[model samples]
Each structure stands twice: as C-alpha cells, then as structure tokens.
Target: MKKLLLLVGGSAGLGEALYSHYKNLDYDIVEFSRSGQQPEHVFLDMSRKETAIDTIDLQFAQLAKQPWQEIVLIINAAQIGPIGELAMSEPKQWWQNIEVNLTLPISIMGRFQTHFQAVEAPKNIAFVSSGAATSVIEGWSLYSATKAGVEHFIRVVAQEQSSKSNPITPVILNPGIMDTQMQATIRSSSEAQFSNVDWFKQAHETGQLASPATVAGNIAAVLSGKLEAGQVYDVSG
Candidate 1:
C-alpha cells in the first residue's frame, strides 16, 4: 500500500511547495484547489462554502478505492486578508475569511474523523496554522480570531481521536512568517486595518521572511510523524 498525501489549496504559495516536495516523496497525491490547473486536482472553490464539503466528500469517496497504508491530510488553504478591525472591515469579506480559515477546515476534519473511525490504517491530519492563533494583532481582529479558533478546533480533534484503537495523529503547525504571497498582502495592508503593516513591509524589504519551501519541508516532517501529535509546534524549532 502506498502513502496518500492529500493537499488542500496547493495551487500556490506554501501549499504549492508542499505538493512539489511530497510528490517527489512518492506519495499518491490528491489536491483540492480553486485554480484546478491539473486534471488530478479536485476543484474546490474556497469562496464557495456551500459546495466545499461535498467536493471533499466526492474526492474522499474516489480515493477510497486505493489500498493505502496511511493517509495524510495537510490543510494549507487560508483566506487571510481583508485586513482590518473587525467592526470596520467589509462584512461579507470578513465572513468569507472566517468561512475559509475556520469553518471550512473544521467541517472537512469532521468528515475525516467520521469516515476513518473504523479504518485501522495510520492517519495524520495537520493544519498550517500561524502565531496569529495566539498573538492578538491590532486591526487583524478577524484573522486573529479565526486562527485562534482553528487551534481550539485542533485541541478538540486531538481529544476526540485520542481514544480510538488505531488513532489518527493531529498536529497544529505554526510555520512562522513565511515568504508567501500572503506576506505580500500583509505588507500592502493599510495602517488603519493592520497597524503592524510597517513591520511586515520591513520584513519583506530586508528579506527577513522564511522561504515557503523550507517551511514546507518542516510541515512535511510533522505529517510524516517526526513530531508528536496533539500539540502545537513551531517549524523553526
């Protein structure tokens, strides 16, 4: 049986880096993304919450035909920035960010938990989370709140899966400040919405940010079970 690597949001950024690395590692890869650039990738529009769950289900059903010893789910899709104070932010966009960063992954994890409950194969679920999960950044109320919410969801998943006979490993990976397009978006944020915009701008200007490829390697380690489960870990460490 082959190792199956499932990537959500692999069209670009760190997710793309992860896909490339794991594809070379010989895992049978599956991707879910909005771009849908390849025939093998399952089309999943992060903006369309209504269809996301079903798309995941359909993909899972199709992949079930494969005889696999392990399944690793790496959730790298994030709706990072309509950056601003929650009250001042555009309502619809803010809601969508929450939907992408928090609701979507949780719902998908729920499906994974139920589907694999009876399967004895080793499983690993990892989320590409951020320090924003705990750090309160001014003008980033929505982003901060959603990241924090995601970590709590991780905690719950850890607890829920701990007692299973052939338990799934869950990891919340804090990949540090990676040099992704998301960083550029943060650098371009208005001061009114993101007070620490200058910090991000400076980071990029001085080339201080970590490369996505490097962080992607660290995340791969977590998914490979090099790190302990049910805990929050920083890749830099």
Candidate 2:
C-alpha cells in the first residue's frame, strides 16, 4: 500500500515545495490549506477552529484503515500576524495567532496518535518552526510567543510518545530563515513596525536567505529518517 503524506498548509510556500517533493516520491499526498481547489484537498482557514475540526474529521475517515506501512505528517501551517506591538494589536487577532500556532497542532497530533496507536509502523510528525521561538523581536510579540509555546508543546508530546510500544514520534523543527513570502512581508515592513526590517531586506538583497525547497528537503529528511528527542533541529545548518 502507498504511504500517506499529510501536508498541512500545502497550498503555498515551503508547504507547496514539500508536497511536490513528496508527491514525486509516490506518497499518497493529502493537502490541507485555505485553497479549495480540489475535492481531495482539505480547506483550512487557520484563523477559525472549525476548519481544523473539519479537516481532522475528514482525515480520520480516510485513515480509519491506515493500512499503509506508515503515515508521514508535516505541519507547515503558521500565522505571523498581530505585528507592530502587543498593546496596539487587537485581542482577537492575537488570540487567533495563538490558536493557530499552539492549539491546532495539539488537536491534530492527538487525533492522529489515538487513531494510529494500534498500527506497528512508526508515524513521524514534524512541525515547521522558526528562530522566532527564542527571539524577542520588537514587532513580533504574538508570533514569537506562539512559536515558543509550540516548541515546548512538542517536547511534551515527545515525552508522552516515548513509551515503549508507541510508534508516534514528534519532531519540533526550526527551518531557519527561508526565502518565502513571509520573508518578503518582513522585508516590506516599515522600520517602526519591524526594527530589523533593514536586516531582513539586506538578507534578501544579498541572497543570504535560504530557498524554501532546500529547507523542505532538510525537514523531509528529519521527519522521514530519525526521531531526535528534545532537539529542535535547525534546517539552516
């Protein structure tokens, strides 16, 4: 049976690249994103919890039989909004960022773990993380806070899944500064909005930013290869 590669946020950026790469490798790719282009693709609007629920419900049905040797999951979905200042940002927007980055991953991972518990094949799950998890950028209060939370959350999941007879492996990854649309947005930010705007702009201008495809390759390698506990593997290195 063909293995399944469930790609969250597969419609764009690093997600798109990973989907293409894994598809070529013959994994049964299921894309979950905001784009409702195909019936097989699960539409996701990260700002809302309902979309995540729907996607989980549908996948539960498909993988109910999870007859393949293993299922690979890559979570490349995140929100970088509520920028500028903590007090200046709207409560709804800031909360939504936390929901997307923190709550959604736990929900998805729990469902998959419960469903695949009996399966003997190891299920490797990876989160697309960033350096912001440990950074204190001036305008990224919401984004930084959420990333930090999930990084620790993954550690908790790792401990829970570490027991013998459990095939679930969780990996919290820091994919580094990639030349994605998010980087472009940072590059365009005003100095007041982002203190390091010139730094990012220079990275782009000097071709220092990593390619999305390259980072995706590093992610795919870790998720499909090994489970290094408590380590946040940075793809840049």
Candidate 3:
C-alpha cells in the first residue's frame, strides 16, 4: 500500500530527521518550508497565512487524486523569537510568531480535514509542540503562549474528531530540548534576553541534549504505537 507523508518545516532539525526517516521507508514525501536543501521541499511561508493556505489547498487538490493507503500531516514549523522580555519585544515580531506557531497549524489542519474528509485511508495529524507550553520560562512569553495555544487547539480538534465516523488521529508532541538550530538560538541569547541561556549552554556542553534524529525516531514510534489522540507525547520519556 502506498503511503504519503505531508510535512511542514521538514527542511532542518527534527523535521529534516522525520523526512529522512519516512523517505527511507519508501513513503511518498512532500515537505513544505520556506527554504530547504532537499528537492522535495515546497516553498510555503507559514508567516503569510493566506498565501500559505492557498499553497496547501493547491497541493491537497493534486494529492486527492492519488490513491494512498495512509496519509500523515506533521506540522513542525514554529518560531521561537522575540526572546527578550515581553514588554521590550516588538509587537510585530510577536504577531508573526503567533501566526507561524499557532495560526498556520490550525489552518493547515482545517484544510487537511476538509480536503480529505471522504478519503478512506487512515489519516494522522501531529503537531510539534514544546514543553514550554506548560512551563513558565522567563523571556519566552510569546513562544510559550503560542505553544500553549497549539496544545489546547489539538485537544479541541481531537474532541471534534471523536464524533466523526472516520476521524483523523491528532497527536500533540513535546519534543524536549534537542541539539537543533532552535537550541542554538536559545544558547546564543544573552542572559538579559534569555535567563535560561546558561542552562541551555550547559546542556550542550555536558551533552545533555538529545539529537534531532533520536527524537524523530521516538515520534515515529509513538505514531505507530497505540497512541491516544490528543495526549502529549514527550519524546524524552
């Protein structure tokens, strides 16, 4: 049976790891990102809502014509910026962060459900959320807020799916701190900008950070296992 993997932000970090993992399994992979090293990557800027939705709509139109035994949509695109205190950060950047981390994911889920509602194949949607969603971290107000919002949105989606005869499985992921570009950004921040900068640096120096590939593998395992929809799967655990 042919399988399809539609991934967002599958250019680098854990997203890249997921792309490679599924590709190795001979799954037809299509990745959406702003820029990517892989030829399969389709440029779709999540920061621009309307354009991004249009792009996904076009892609879904084409994908609907294909026959697949299973289809998975994993949304890993996120922004972790405006790291400083909330009062000192620019409102424009905060809004952009919210759009990428929250708005785009929700929009994509809606589009996916709408387009594939009649498809008999098994459908799965996973969002790469963070532990920050439930924790309070200084200087990470926007990131935490948006992530929290994404988590709750997943729960709502899962509830809605419970009523459908053919429901899409929704999973929320808490991929712990990994040695990714996002971690590099966190480690690069000054103490003034990010109070936990030293802690992240120590994790890197002491080899406490998990590799993106390892986390990606764990996520794949969770998706394949007996997963309860809407529950947050922590890769570290």
Best by lDDT: 3
Cα-based lDDT at residue 127, candidate 1: 88
What are the models' TM-scores? 0.94, 0.93, 0.97
What's the lDDT for all of these models?
0.82, 0.79, 0.89
Q: How well is each residue in 76-172 modelled by candidate 2, as lDDT tens digits?
A: 8988876788777688888898888878877777777777767776677888777888977889987887878877888887887778485577787
Q: In model 3, what lDDT does residue 124 have?
A: 88
What local lDDT score does residue 226 receive in model 2, on the 0 to 100 scale?
63
Error of 2 at 30 (Å): 0.7
lDDT of 3 by residue, 115-205 (tens): 8877888898999998889999999988999889988988998999989988888999888989999999998899999987998999999
Best-fitting candidate, scored by TM-score = 3
lDDT of 1 by residue, 1-237 (tens): 889988998988888888889888988888899885655588888777779998987778667666788899889899777787667756888879989998998888887776765667788888888888888788777777887888888888788777878787888988889788898888878888788899888878888888888988887776666646668878742
Return the TM-score for candidate 2, rounded to 2 decimals.
0.93
lDDT of 3: 0.89
Ranking by lDDT: 3, 1, 2
The clash count for each model shown is: 0, 0, 0
- Candidate 3, TM-score vs. the true structure? 0.97
Error of 3 at 118 (Å): 1.7
Ranking of models by TM-score = 3, 1, 2
Higher-scoring candidate on lDDT, 2 or 3: 3
